[model samples]
Target chain A: MNVDLIDLGNESRNAGSFVSFLDQICARFELDHAAYAGTNPVASAVHGYVNYPDAWKHHYAENGLHRIDPTLLVASRSIAPVDWSRLDHTEGFEKTFRDARDFGITNRGLTIPVRGPYGDIGMLSVTRDCSVTEWEKLSRQILPDLQSVAVHVHDTVMRSDVLSRALRYPALSTREREILQWIAAGKSQQDVGDILGISHRTVEVHLRSGREKLYALTTPQAVGRAIMLGLIYPL
Target chain B: MIIIVDALNKDRFGDLLDEMFKLRARVFGDRLGWEVEITNGREIDQFDRLDPAYVIGLDDEGHVVSCVRALQTTGPHMLSDVFQVLLDGEPPLRSATLWESTRFCVDTQRLCRDGNTMKAVSMATCELMIGSLEYARRSGISDIITVIDPVVNRVLKRSDNAPYDYVGSTKQMGKVPAMAALLDCTEERINRVRAFAGITHDVFANEDTVRDLLDARQLAFAAQLGESSEWMAAILSGSEEALPPVLPEDIQDYCRAQIETAQTEEEHAAALRLVAVLVRERVHPAMHRLVFQS
Candidate 1:
């Protein structure tokens, strides 16, 4: 597709633009297919030049793998990009993993699990079928950049400001705004507080206020609203 | 890091549409066993322009693949306030959540379509549905409803429960499968669903309305202001071409096995050989041309 990376770099790191840029990247990598799915109530989905079977996706969703979505769950808990193969498959992942593999998921894959300031959990992943040597080389070579790219695209598509837009409120103080922003970016209260030099309680207060203003009943909802509003970026 | 969402610029709409078309042709061709229509590339609907398609998901290359194609029903769609007869005399327009997630398609032909991800109409649709609920919930939209094909509606029903109660019935929509409606799309109904289905909430249609809409053909209705009440019958049941759904348990495993085995090659190597043989045979005469190029 010959897209300008700088343009993608400019977009807030969210799932949308990440999907877009990935399309270009897939072309660059000479790959044929890809997809990006956000873990939300509505569970929005994005697609790359490649596509997957519906029966498979339906099976995955119908089976409710998000609870045990090892990649998504683990990625949510960390800021590092993980190789799909490196994840622990010892327990609670037989069906999901089997299904993923049967569907031709690359044993050699990378998922940059991103946690924003407010506990917004997302993953930027890349998959490919390659020899063990080639896989190792690609992981060592592209893993670092892939993590950053995943974060960037994740933050861009879901650009924060989801708070006010959700509840019809004005923007909050930059610090608090930044906190909500981080929250939408997928960071936890302790993390957000630590980043802003505030107590977890204080972070809670800011989030509570933001949550109230956004009229969100749950933390995930609050983060979702914040992302929709452009109040935060997944950097 | 935080992720932000902004509507795509108008300039990029064409770029997006082209992608949508190609994706649809790819997926529908393989998954549903349907023909492809890419003359001008693909089909464009009235809703495509009015609604901003929201695509979210990661591609295999760790990039974003946005599938944004839908329109909120603020005015009228489907039954069009036009040459339409109301199954419900007054058209059940109450405080309900209803929206048509229409012409949903995704490209599945290329790129080893992901099993975890939705491709073609399915993925595009799932993406739209997921994002729409999140967006609508945040936007304080309560009622949400959609009238979809029966097979598609069954998929929705199986996945999660909606807030408002809905009514559904199969209709002779032609083709391999019949069409049906899943009613009960109210914000309140969706909220209940969110609580129970343990997912985000989105309103869907009311079941009674759905039934009334389909069964209206059986009821008596006044043609004009002073016209006699015309007693109608056999609206939903009139069609002779539509096949009825069998109980899942009732579906013959042996028949399915036969089809699977028939397609097998390598001198009857079971399902695997059958599918492989089918792929080889079809490709040689058909799929082969499409696939060999790859």
Candidate 2:
């Protein structure tokens, strides 16, 4: 796997080639499936290729499972690789996994999170169906190599033209942009509303929409993005 | 102040890291004449994409004065990949407790301009050394194998933080000779470096101090841009989480992410504040499940 990673630079040129790379990885490691998902920092859209069964992929997309998939939700937030067995079997996890089992997917898996300097996050998850002890030993042995692979895959994908072209900046409305600018200038929502002669609730609405458009999970993040995108100028 | 920037907090210190990278470009690509890739005034390579921990020193005004890169030896590192020639014929050392320290540099030009050139450079260098060693020691790293030139080697020895041994014989690389030297992450070593620099207080900056400095800088920038003073005053008096209320689930998810990625003591405190907010919002069930389950 380490040797393969050395040549990953030449192989993974686009999403299609990356899928083939994942297939080769699954075959070499004797894993059932290998999946990679990453949030494109510029576009703020999720993009990647997975080697899961077609039906399961379709089901996952139809259900918007990425938002609640424990493998992604939990792992993407972590700096360390997360073992599937350690995840909490919450309602979302139960729904996702129970359906996954129907597709002949094992609940046993490992997800390695890779973070880029630009705040982009990539997750490489691999699952192998086997006895508990065998799974544990295999995961333990391959953890380091898997971590390297995750970084390689993420850097390659980030450099790919496919992702670069997908850099669609979300268009914020005039009001949204104005509110974000005020926020970036250190104005609170109430102050912004009072300055703009709008109700505070209306100010909140615009800020919420601005955050959604920016794909920012927090207001500070939204303000940061707005400033970076030049929608708001702090200086 | 020396700060350790890793995958989790890299976003918070992006500008600082950029300054460090630009310093690397000046030192490695220009000064040292090494064949390093320099793009947009930043010297960043594939290893940097792997999220290596960076021990960076910042002056009172938050300029990157010194920096070093640390990558685990258990995976691909400069010694195993880029500088294999320095390893002779022996296989690269790979161990969970070992890390490779490379790209160690100081902004001698900037430091020298501040005070006595030699004193400033040595102080920043020793501060960075102590910072990396203490950080590595806390993170359970036992040893560090660093690639450095003879000049840095001499400085290390003079500071009493000399490498305990050498990995391979020195070889001429680019304009200078380079060697791989080994250093143990021990209390005595940190103490020696601290003593040499006459640094008694903690080298690592308090998180709140860092945050306040950054905020002040931002506010100053805004003021310089002609932002209304009233708005700046309001921000100054505003609570930390003064943004519009997000959904409970969103808050919970954000808090969970914060908790999972928290590394430093102050980061944990911030995460705890998020948990407290979640509890106050009556979103205890989901937060409770996420917290206790993990």
RMSD of each predicted structure? 24.1, 25.2
How close to the true structure is residue A193 of candidate 2, measured as C-alpha lDDT? 83
Docking class of 1: incorrect
lDDT of model 2 at residue A163? 54
Candidate 2: which stretches are off by over 4 Å?
A: A1-235, B221-294
- Predicted complex 2: CAPRI docking category: incorrect
TM-score of only chain B in every candidate structure: 0.44, 0.74
- The stretch of ten residues in a row with the least summed lDDT in candidate 1 chain B is B225-234
Q: Model 1 over residues B150-222: C-alpha lDDT tens digits? A: 5556556554542222322334332333232323323454454345445443323232343344235223222
Q: What would the per-residue lDDT of candidate 1 be over residues A1-235, giving only the tens digit for each residue?
A: 1223444423564555555666765655544334444432222333222234566567777888766766665544332345566465535445567777777665456665443323244565566777878866755655433433444444443343455124223244454568877776667778887888766644554454454334343456556666776765645
lDDT of 2 at B51: 68
Q: Where does the lowest 10-residue lDDT sum fall in candidate 2 chain B?
A: B227-236
Q: Model 1, which residues run further than 4 Å from truth?
A: A1-235, B1-8, B25-38, B51-68, B81-97, B105-128, B162-168, B176-294
